[model samples]
Target: MRVIEAPSPNHEPRAAGVPLDTVVVHYTGMPTAAQAIDRLRDPAAKVSAHYLIETGGRVLRLVPEGRRAWHAGVACWQGLSDINSRSIGIELVNRGHAWGYHPFPESQLESLRVLLADILARYGIPPARVLGHSDVAPERKTDPGELFPWRTLAAHGLAVWPDPVQPPAETPPVAWFQARLAAVGYCTPQSGRLDDATAAVLAAFQRRFRPKAVTAAPDTGTAARLMGLTASA
Candidate 1:
């Protein structure tokens, strides 16, 4: 992917026998890409992704894929909590939710598609394991946010995306939603009731999948989409 080496000291060896089976996507969420790079290189900050894709289509390698870059803080996926040990993190340059979220440029997305293909092939990471930072840390994070063009990534075969859902005759029960999300690899609370934790997880799911109505208030489209996820995946 024609990466320019820009190593950061904020990384370490992955845990022994940790499978590199996942890829976590993130947006810088900072005011500028340069600022984001600066923070990532800052030792005290203790945060770094394996690579950063800039707005101008430049790719910077901050850490070797073999190491655990201090990303995915306090996160979990499926039943595994040591996410940083098992995944590769890619940071895209964008002023996410905090500063001013916007659509990624064509050049940036094109570069991302190429980079993702290389990483997926190198590690043999499955499409289902490709996730956003929000997916693994539902209650604590929402990055590579709703406007992040997940469907486009899916089109490139980087991940899965459900088709337009046919709203069901009746809304599926909350437990149904919980089961579907769990099956799709999210560490969702399978409580029969839609509690706060469940809702936040659903919101993270919606933010990536059914973004049109991300209220976390379960509806027919959301339910139908959930039902279709596994089949599509």
Candidate 2:
């Protein structure tokens, strides 16, 4: 991991006393890396991340890991808010959902594995705490999109992967899904119904662990995966 320092003036001091224990992955989502880099560096944009990985595997350092980069806005995870205060944000350069989302290149994934391992060593970020931008703010964002290689990350010991499980004949109720999602570290909706927010959370989970089915509507397979991951956690 040779990192190029490409500083951005869009960060602020992290909160007074917050332990940086989480890693949030995102996709640049612009037409090109240069445009995304410009947006991140522009102070008026009020957004930046600790680093950005280009498609060809070049790593650019935008903000110091010690400061808050204002990457996550209106996001939550496991009942915690103000995520930017306690997380390291890494933007993977890809044209996300809006611009014809595509699979991440092998070069990019290779560099991400190295970068994540280095950051996790310093902060001891847990596998379950390695999450996507969509994981924290499913209702507002989807980056490092469904096409991202989460299983590859898990194979490298950078994140967690659920073991295969047989789903019960009947799909679990929405309330059950909500409970299990919460247990698996998501900020689930407590409404006891299949609301959009809850569905978004479920989709995020599937994107991470069950990319085969991302319906957002709970199914037997989704339920089984959720149960397995929740139990493992």
Candidate 3:
């Protein structure tokens, strides 16, 4: 619950009339926490997050919540492109996919749970809005990757986790999957084809909802999870 002030300058005033309603989780995809912190604080880098949690449960406030930190670059969510303007970005310290993908430590997750609870309550943001960086920018990024314990967060009502439902008896068409993904807040391809864009989005979706196998194909389990989320939404 202790937050150390370590402000970064790579932020700007949010656009007028934009409601802060989302929280994007990310991993500091660097070799070490010091390197990540240095880059985030470096004005030349021009990227930062509101908070950065180290592996040992230390939380650093990098950018004030009132300003738009330049974390979510070239991303879209639920049809909105100005994600940073309406979201608080939290970066978890980890040597992400580029270095060595691994499970987040228990202490780190514990801090995340505590931090998320406070942020969600204060901003009135829903659990559904607690999204991963990959969820928002599927094609370009995948931090806070598959190994992150989303189910643990869902248990605390901080994030959404779909119930285990049987995969559909038969596979549905690409268009069917497309509509449900859109409904579930993904900016998916609507071209009705299983193109690379659609697959990237599906892979990102699976990375969150069905992490065991991120096949990127419109498989039965992925489709079922998509259906379940869309129905609940």
Predictions in order: lDDT: 0.90, 0.88, 0.92
Clashes of each: 0, 0, 0
Q: What lDDT tens digits, residue by residue, belong to model 3 across residues 12-80?
A: 999899999999999999999999999999999999999999999999999999999999999998899
Better of 1 and 2 by TM-score: 2
Model 1: per-residue Cα lDDT over 101-144, one tens digit each: 99888899899999999989988888888999999999989998
Model 3: what TM-score?
Answer: 0.98
Clashing pairs in 3: none
What is the TM-score ranking, best to worst? 3, 2, 1
For candidate 3, the lDDT comes to 0.92
State which candidate, 2 or 3, has the greater TM-score.
Answer: 3
lDDT for 106 in candidate 3 is 91
For candidate 3, give the lDDT of residue 173.
93
Better of 1 and 2 by lDDT: 1
Q: Could you give me the TM-score of model 2 versus the true structure? A: 0.97
